[model samples]
Target: MTVVGIGYVGLSAALLLSQYNKVYALDISPEKIYKLNKKISPLKDT
Candidate 1:
């Protein structure tokens, strides 16, 4: 499945669904893509 937008919400949802599905996260932001590729949070929620 494809999950557009790799934000916190998208990431969480993708992770949950990834257990039984292949998630292809799409985003226009390079930073977000970079962080996700490196397994890092793009935004600081704290």
Candidate 2:
């Protein structure tokens, strides 16, 4: 499944859905994508 945008809500949904299904999170930020690819949290929602 493809989830567009890796924001707080989007990322949360992707992570939750990924447990049972394949999820590809999409975002407009290259830095964010790079961090996510490296298993790092892209945004700190606090």
Candidate 3:
């Protein structure tokens, strides 16, 4: 499945769907793209 955007909603959905299928996340933001590419969490951990 393909998911556009990497904000809260898009990222969450991608994570869920990625469990069962290959997920392609697309975002125009360089920062977001970079973070995902590096497997870094965009949000702060608890």
lDDT per residue, candidate 1, 2-38, as tens digits? 9998778998889999999888989999999998899
Q: lDDT by residue for model 3 over 1-46, one digit each (tens)?
A: 9999888899999999999999999998898889999999776657
> Which number leads on TM-score?
2
When summed lDDT is taken over every stretch of 10 residues in candidate 2, the lowest stretch is 37-46
Better of 1 and 2 by TM-score: 2
lDDT of each: 0.88, 0.92, 0.90
The model with the greater lDDT, 1 or 2, is 2
Candidate 1 weakest ten by summed lDDT: 37-46
Candidate 1 Cα misplacement greater than 4 A, ranges: none
Report how far off residue 24 is in candidate 2 (Å): 0.9
Ranked by TM-score, the better of candidates 1 and 3 is 3
How many steric clashes between backbone atoms does each model show? 0, 0, 0
Full ranking by TM-score: 2, 3, 1
